[model samples]
Target: ADLSQKSHRYVRSEPGGPPGKDVYSLLRCRVLLGRPYLIEGNLLAPNALHDFLLCDDPTDALETVAEDWVTTGHDAFYVRGLQRSAKSERGVYNSEYIVFHAWQALPLYRVDYTLE
Candidate 1:
């Protein structure tokens, strides 16, 4: 995800520094990409059942974990999409969160375009 096209602003506050030199980084787009492989086997982890499965294919992994969650009632993560701000004038921004078991899946790409 290329964030070069997004409109953004940078703020810097320094006691005795050159103008706009305090902060070097600002709002930018970050991306994460990953590849998962599919495996056919019965998952049997001693603990952390609700965690995202580490696999070649996340779709198949998710299905395997979901089926286990249904049959065993194990802990799991849920996806949540949240607005970046309740009130904004520029445009709409959004963010997503994995409430639980975020560390289970192998992270590939994380696209983050956050501004503060």
Candidate 2:
């Protein structure tokens, strides 16, 4: 992503997730070389920014230790994406107190763009 083009702003788009639901997310975009493009952000650990996060990847399920070995908390260090994980069956949502063992796929938000 182009650091020089990165711009943060608030926007209201059509609701597609649920009815009467207020959703919030961080959006980072850039305009480089007079061309408008979207820039992707990553979920990083405060202690390990270079390391890849499993939560950032799409999968039926994700498993991470409740306790962080390197850091003090198992927090989601997001730049502009998912804010929290449920730590239950829903994992990321508070649908059920149960933990979902069944393979449940999640949508990937990672996108990329380049200037030609």
Candidate 3:
């Protein structure tokens, strides 16, 4: 499937906002799908809630375009994408290195905790 053809919307947390306040942004991203096993490294990070990894190098990172998409119960789909380190003509990375990044959905809370 050519995942990059579609624009995916994602909710991202704004890094710097009003003190003691949380802000978010809706991002429309273009991504390419790939294999799930292509993700390298460990699932847990020091203090991160989601699991992700950095490809060994730029070429390896670019392969993440084939990573599979993960869907959450809240109806959010997440996966990794190849981002260029610097801007290039026509969105082509050329010789610039690529970065691998992924997304995750926040925890969901059910109003009715007890089962009927």
CA lDDT of each candidate? 0.30, 0.28, 0.30
Best candidate according to TM-score: 3
lDDT tens string, model 3, 49-89? 12324432222233223344334211222223224532232
Runs of candidate 2 with Cα error greater than 4 angstroms are: 1-9, 29-116
Off by over 4 Å in 3: 1-23, 38-53, 57-116
Backbone collision tally, model 2? 5
Report the CA-based lDDT of candidate 1 relative to the real structure.
0.30
Instruction: Return the TM-score for each candidate structure.
Output: 0.19, 0.15, 0.20
Clashing pairs in 2: 60-104, 86-91, 89-98, 89-99, 89-100
TM-score-superior candidate, 1 or 3: 3
Ranking by lDDT: 1, 3, 2
lDDT of 3: 0.30
Q: What RMSD, rounded to one decimal, does every model reach?
A: 12.8, 17.7, 16.4
- Which stretch of 10 consecutive residues in model 2 shows the poorest summed lDDT? 92-101
- Report the lDDT of model 1 for residue 58: 29
Q: Give candidate 2's TM-score.
A: 0.15
